[model samples]
Target: MTDDPTPGTRCRACGGAAGTVVLDLGEQPPWDRMPARDAPLPDPAAPLRMWLCAGCGLAQLQTDAAVAEELHGVEPLAMTEQSDRSVGRLARAGLVRPGGRVAEFGSPHGGSWLPRLTGRGMVALDADAVSAAGRADLVVDFYGLLHEPDQADALARRVALLAPGGTLALQLLSLGTVLRDDQWFDLRHGHYGYWSLPALDAALRRHGLGVHRAWWYPLSGGTVLVTARAGAEPDAGTRRLVDEERALAVTEPSGFARLQAAADDTHLLLDWLVAERAAGRTVAAYGAASRAVPLVCRAGLDASLLAAVGDASPAKQGHRMPGSDVPVVSPDELAGLHPDRVLLFLPELLDEVRAALPQVEASGGRWVVLGPGPRAVEPVSALSGC
Candidate 1:
């Protein structure tokens, strides 16, 4: 609320002035806001950065640039597919009990594991039905923790909602993967904290929950579904996850400068787009995701280098991406255009999108994966002959 964000001295989780700046991405608009097609470019960009809390070993946004308005997006087919596979893994692992009470904390963007729970014979409860605390056998929050402004309070509530021996299932972006993979863009306004199992173990223990078990997945760069229960200790599997994190030295503040280095690579995407343009190849992009905003804006992209972007969500189609003039179109329209190259913003969704837009390849267009490098990862055609 001041001219600049407070020099973040205190840890968001532990309330200790025991942290240091790790990454700093200069002034950026609220990435979540998609402006009206004719609206002015995003204004009043503020400093975007991440900090490492030595006290709790948590990585967090130093301060919020602005209060964000939720941008509704259709849950990608890949996310949906991951949800099914994750829940099925939980059931097979015996973490899910038959006919138990299930409570969910869905992301603001909207998606829930309740339907999957109900299919597993568990009873799903609405938010109001959950206030009689500690009643749930399973309290699930996938991709929900980072959105919370108050990390301490959020953890407390998720803990309080659990019954004795209840499993609080959390799917978090594994900090080890973030640092090791150079996914620096994950640092953004509105994302409060990044969790390593070590830091999270400290935070959860404060709330009477202990890390119990974990499962890793290659979604969203990398993700982990960690189970925490009251009075539990780090089980054998949990210890292994923690040990892997230690090997990466993720909790150290200086090691985090790697992200600052990645941020300096903003020109990478623009270079690829320019090459495509020189070849007279018309280019479009897919996914108007929040993470794509910083990358697109930082690279100084416009409708010229990157043409229209296709999104599955109707709410976003008529709007332009914030800070740029690129129009958002529907998926059907995206494939129909048969662009020479369609840059996919979210690499983790590569498979699902390939199947969804088979026409792009059938007509001689190749789908290019956008990331550290814009490379054609799939065969010339993914689904055509199959």
Candidate 2:
């Protein structure tokens, strides 16, 4: 709860000269700069703060979150499932038209909307290829928009690539959900913007695009699929989403003050882990996700506190959590350890992980979901309820 030490004077989306400090996570290593196992104890730290633009509702990272380098991140099964479901719904809604031209924006996670669209009798074009291939009937961006350093330019380019009356189906982690769930951890270095329905409406209007339809999914706490078309009017569903954001005060920086509590509570995890070690409860963790990087470091954790972190991605397997001595191991190695408690950092992966790691339960070990504090994973996993 202190004001941002490094205040951001300009907004990324609307080029507003001034904005309000929303949430600050102090200084932490960039998520992509994962140190090698034996490299060092502390990596470089940078300001990590979220700012809310008064002119536009967009909340963007005020501090720089530049990538030190590239590290592959495996897409969770939950995301794959959600994509399939999203495509089906979009097609039913007539956005994915037959013989329609589709363009997909870049995503760090390796996957393509091409094959899925081609199978539906739609032509596929990469967002980059749209220049020669001409405008697209539908453009899709999922979790890619926030990575752009220039938010206004990014949106303008994508909207320009759309054909007259074309739709842009954007799926973003709902800012409303982040505020409601207090997911301050999402405020990382590389992620430049957070989108609420109201905020996105303002940003899109700048490019002559208007949101016409919207849908919600449970993936990533909450995800919103918004369909916008040039000069289109907001449908009832879209209006409702904007109204919901207004109710949450999404446009007000002070409204996001709740996030500071989550920032304060992160240290509780370190405390719990320390006490668990003292009590002789063998503890290890799963999911060496980029999201877990700062939490691992800021808590001042090491292999002594957390035995090891398990990740499915082979790229991260040999590398350790950045800024800490904890090693990232394969899921098989993690299972071999059989620690009494396994902290599940990414709670949304609970169902898929449960099916894949039955051995943890079979071996008399229980999975604990990491929240503000640790909570035992019940039969039905729920992040907010936990």
Candidate 3:
């Protein structure tokens, strides 16, 4: 498949200079949404050096590589998994209480939550012409564009479609988080506009909607979940979130530095693992299909040293990790290989995995975690994987 666009140009988000080169991931293919094996792969293109916008602190491409954006199709499954908990929480929090009406912007092929909401009387809307068909009380084509008269008309139509006293919930990535964190990875082609707190509030107000609540949720580093209502003015909650975001200095360089250092430390851990292998110890990687691929690839781990990367996703089992090209398999394979150590890629899943360690121990192995922070190793039977 085609690689990420090279970086050497001005920032598209902030029009700032591309500052210091933070990470230079040479040639690598896309991850997460890789196509089925039979699907034709796009021409390979290496992403040059990725840069940080010193002014806005957004990570961005200097030039468009392949049409990764245009190639993006509705990842309904991914979105459904990511937003299900957020939606359930919002419902419990009264944003979409029983009998409440709602509209989701850029709704992916009728999100899975659409059925859950429809069961409770909520309307689901999609701006993209292409979408997955799912059960919802109402489904409408709604697009989000800027400065376009058509966009204004669509906004009006969506807001008018909402029942009076109903809430409009928005699940959009926060540009403030992306920009401040220099998460250039967030600047994927699929995402067009960056929605800062002010920008989101202004958009809601312009469309005759009032912002009632604005909060941060961790979806791909960070995202903002906002609840709005027609004719309601922007509330203090929105402003408070914006001010707090600023006060927290979420965009400070320190965060990027810390992440970079963490990446470096993960590299050190992988290096140690490779050395251990050279000294005659087998290592099997656990938890495939994670955000750690970029970090692991950047660390230059040997693919052969890894017996097989384990993941629960059937979609990922036969494929390989992006840059490293390590084969992915199911956890059952771990017991077969019987490696001395299993590198836990998903630290969040540690508890569940630890609970299953007694079964995994049939292979007689230990585990290590190369998380976002540092490397920690412990015998599989030691801490219950907590």
Candidate 4:
């Protein structure tokens, strides 16, 4: 990765001067660069700093350099169940109709919600192809805008692709929820910007779009779903959410203080992990999600502290973590390997992992989850492990 011309200098949304530095994650490798077992790893690391825009109150990553040409190189784990649920929710909210033309942006192969548009006409396109895809009744940009360098321009393109009064659905990580919980795992190199309800509403309103409906899903830690239409006005619910976010001090300096404090405490947790390993206690990790690359690096965890990182996705198995030599193994091997304790990278997928590795607990193994706070470690009971 090349150095950003103006590192930690400007906001991507409003182009304002860099605001308060809420959380500095130090230097981290690009999260998506998973190298093959025999391939040499990339040495470049960029500063992962989150800045709050004073002008628009938008929280964004300060790295202006593009890490990779494409965000995702392979297909992500399919969330068919969640897709089905979202389809139902949209239908109930009257955003999906029988014959409506729908376009899904940033959808990976085999993981798209396009199948849900059974009777509707649907097309799936990457961020760059939206201009050529023409118009649609519903444009769904799932987890796309967060990685955009110029959010205003990207959103303007989305608006151009939407038919008059058509719905534009954006599924993104909720900065309000992430900040409130102090979840640093959501802060990674791949995301260029984070959006709160107010910031998103503000951006949409600039394009003559208004929030029509919104929902929050607890999946992937926490995600916000907002559906907007061209001429619609911001509803009372939208205003209420904006007020609540403001009350949480989403853009204030104190909010950054809380995050900085949590980050400070994370180092203590890393110290504890190192101590545990020195005591001859075996420690491994579950899930090799891309976000884990930065978390593991920031925590100073290496192959020495962790035995191996296990992931269920075949795409990631047999690969080495980008900046480290830690091996990514199949989750099935966890029970057989039988580490004394396994640190879960994705807390949201804990139950699924427990079900898959029932014998890990039965054999006196433990699971550790880092969370809502830096030092917040919730150890799963040996009895409830399965």
Best by TM-score: 2
Query: What are the models' TM-scores?
Result: 0.92, 0.94, 0.65, 0.87
lDDT of 4 by residue, 250-331 (tens): 7765665677666666676578678878899887888787667777777777678787888767777887776787888887
Q: How many angstroms is residue 298 displaced in model 3 relative to the true structure, after the best TM-score fit?
A: 0.8
Q: Model 1 segments beyond 4 Å from truth?
A: 1-5, 128-134, 381-386
Estimate candidate 1's RMSD in Å: 2.9
**Who wins the lDDT comparison?**
1
Off by over 4 Å in 2: 1-8, 379-386
- In candidate 3 the C-alpha lDDT for residue 306 amounts to 75
Global local distance difference test of model 2 = 0.81
Q: Summing lDDT over every window of 10 consecutive residues in candidate 3, give the lowest-scoring window.
A: 140-149
lDDT of 2 by residue, 1-386 (tens): 33434544677888875677788777788888777787866677877778877788788888675677557878888878888988888899887767899888856756656677788989887677677447899898867898888999899888978988789888888899888888888888788889898888877888899788888888878888888887778778778877987888888876787888777887788888889899988789988876787678667888898999999989888888877889999889999998888899888887788788878877777788865688877533343364
* Model 4 ranges with Cα > 4 A deviation: 1-8, 38-42, 69-78, 107-110, 119-134, 234-237, 372-386
Candidates in descending lDDT order: 1, 2, 4, 3
lDDT of each: 0.82, 0.81, 0.53, 0.72
